[model samples]
Target: KKRYKAQPIVLAIPRGGVVVGYQVAKELGCPLDIIVPRKIGAPHDPEYAIGAVAQDGSMVLDQKVVKSLGISSSYLEEAKKREIEEIERRMKMYRKNLSEPQIVGKTAIIVDDGIATGSTIKAAILSVKKKNPALLVVAVPVGAPDSIAAIKTLIYDIVVLATSYSFAAGGQFSQNLVQTSDQEVIGLLQKASGPQ
Candidate 1:
């Protein structure tokens, strides 16, 4: 509150992030939006993310993991293409007629339920950086200590409520890890927008 005099916009990484972001935006009386970044999972294990692609086609990849896994360029390209398509679909579904949030002179808080590998959130941060917000802050309820430290190198301003050494996944820290639906995201955005 002391850092920012004007209202800061909260950009959540859906679908779980939206739920967390909604509460944050509501409490702060700020606008809530979504930054859709699809994870590029490993070929063998789809749940294991090797990289992520943001809405603007920008990506963040674990080069070591990509190379060590012998992920071919063709496979990466295919995966990126599919993820981009999904990103487009999600943007259309979530934003609908809403214009992109103007964050040039405002603080942009990128909220997420938690950070595991930090690939997807990194992509989201990169995508938001293009818009040139006055300040970019990464806020999450919980995160891996190493992952949080990695993100700290990119942006110094970040807030993580808890850090776990045994962090297996984000869901482990949360009481409710249910999958958030697209409809729920839309409703939250609408509610945050407040009758617009």
Candidate 2:
């Protein structure tokens, strides 16, 4: 609260982010929401995110990686289409009422457990910027040094608990980093919107 001197709407990058953003919203007595961004993976390397698409369908791609890997345009187009479909599905599943928070003219804080490739967060930031928030802030528990540095060029306000030069994985920071399920995400959103 002192940082901004005003309550900000917390937008979590869902699955894991919802967990962290929920607490932040509760602390400030502000609204909690989500921004779904799907990573566009490399062919045959689904875990490797070469790009990402936000819930609003805005995307950011690493042109260098795309050219180096010889990723075809057809592949990228198809992948984006598929990811967009999944994004819509997730939005319906996570936000049952289909109503999202009002962030225009309000400070918007994007929260996540950690940042890895930074593709997803980049996409989310771009998407949210279109809504014209008074300010945009990213809050994460930890992130890779290089990833965080590159992201710094995009958004000025960043709050990270830790930065590691040799960050292996987000799971490394947690004791039991289990795969976050859709049900868990739904529950958190519900609790946040519940009666005070």
Candidate 3:
């Protein structure tokens, strides 16, 4: 409230973030929505993210990683194309016929269950920044310390419940780590939006 003075809209990173962001939006009495950003991983090591791309084609690349690995422009372009397609698919599945909530001049709180490499969130932040929000904040349950530090310069504020140097994947911090389905995401988005 110190920053926004008004209720802020929450943009939940889908799959897992919907769960966390739903409660936040409910508690804040604000609208809840999503932003889909797909990670562009390394060639051989798919788990190692080199960058991420948003639904609008906005992107964030780890130049150091790309340069060290000698990642080619062709590969990056291909990966970005594929990731943008995925983001579009997910956005369609989640939002369906509903249009995205208006965030211009409003505080945007981007929430996720946790952060790992931070590639996805970074992409989400850059995408949201393009919309010209009043303030951009990242709220998560936990995150890797290095990942948190890496993204600190990009966002207005961060609210992380926990952080650790030895952090692994987000599932490790959860008691019941179920793979959230697209249907679940759709249901949550509908519930958050209420009757039209």
Candidate 4:
């Protein structure tokens, strides 16, 4: 609050990031929201992200990786279409009746559980950038050193608790690697948006 004159709003990347964002919003005494950015995984290895597509259809792709992997333009087009559909489904399930928070002229803090390749978070940042926030920040518990370094070039203010040299994935740091369900995301959003 003291750092920026503008109002701070927390925007979490669902479904794992919602839990972390809720806590951050609660601590900052600000409103919490979600940003949907679906990862465009590699053809053979689904876990390997070649790019990501945001809710507004904005995409961030690793062109070098795409070319190196020989991923066709048609493949990317199909992947984006499929991801956008999933984004729509998620927005419907998670947002429900809630309207998107007013981000223009406010401090938009994009929160995620952690960063691995930084594809998803990069897409989220691009989507939020269109809203014209006064300031953009990325907050996460942990992230890979290389990923965090790459992300640093995108945003000025980033709060990362830990950067691990041995970082394999975000879930590796957690005691429980269980996937956060749609129900859990809905519940957390409801709780955060409730009496404060």
Best candidate, lDDT:
4
Q: lDDT score, residue 156, model 3?
A: 83
C-alpha TM-score for every candidate = 0.94, 0.94, 0.94, 0.95
Write candidate 2's Cα lDDT for 42-103 as tens digits: 99999888999986778999999999999999999899999999999999999998488778
Q: Looking at model 2, report the run of 10 residues with the lowest lDDT sum.
A: 166-175
**Top candidate when judged by TM-score against the true structure:** 4
Q: Could you tell me the C-alpha RMSD of candidate 1 in Å?
A: 1.6
lDDT of 1 by residue, 1-196 (tens): 5677655999999888999999988888788988999999999999888999997888999999999999998999899999999998988999888888898878899999899889999999899999888888999999999999999887739999999987766767765656889899998988888753
Pairs that collide, model 4: none
Model 1: per-residue Cα lDDT at residue 58? 86
Candidate 4 lDDT, 49-151, residue by residue in tens? 8999998988999999999999999999999999999999999899888887899999999999999888999999889999999999999999998999998
lDDT of 3 at 1: 53
Candidate 1, lDDT over the whole model:
0.88
Among all windows of 10 consecutive residues in model 1, the one with the lowest summed lDDT is 168-177
TM-score of 1: 0.94
> Candidate 4's error at 167, in angstroms?
1.3
Q: List residue ranges in candidate 1 displaced over 4 A.
A: 175-177
- For model 3, residues 1-196, the per-residue Cα lDDT tens digits are 5556645999999889999999888888889999988889999997898988998888889999999999999999999999898888788889988897888889999999899889889999989999999889999999999999988999888999999876766866885778778899899999988863
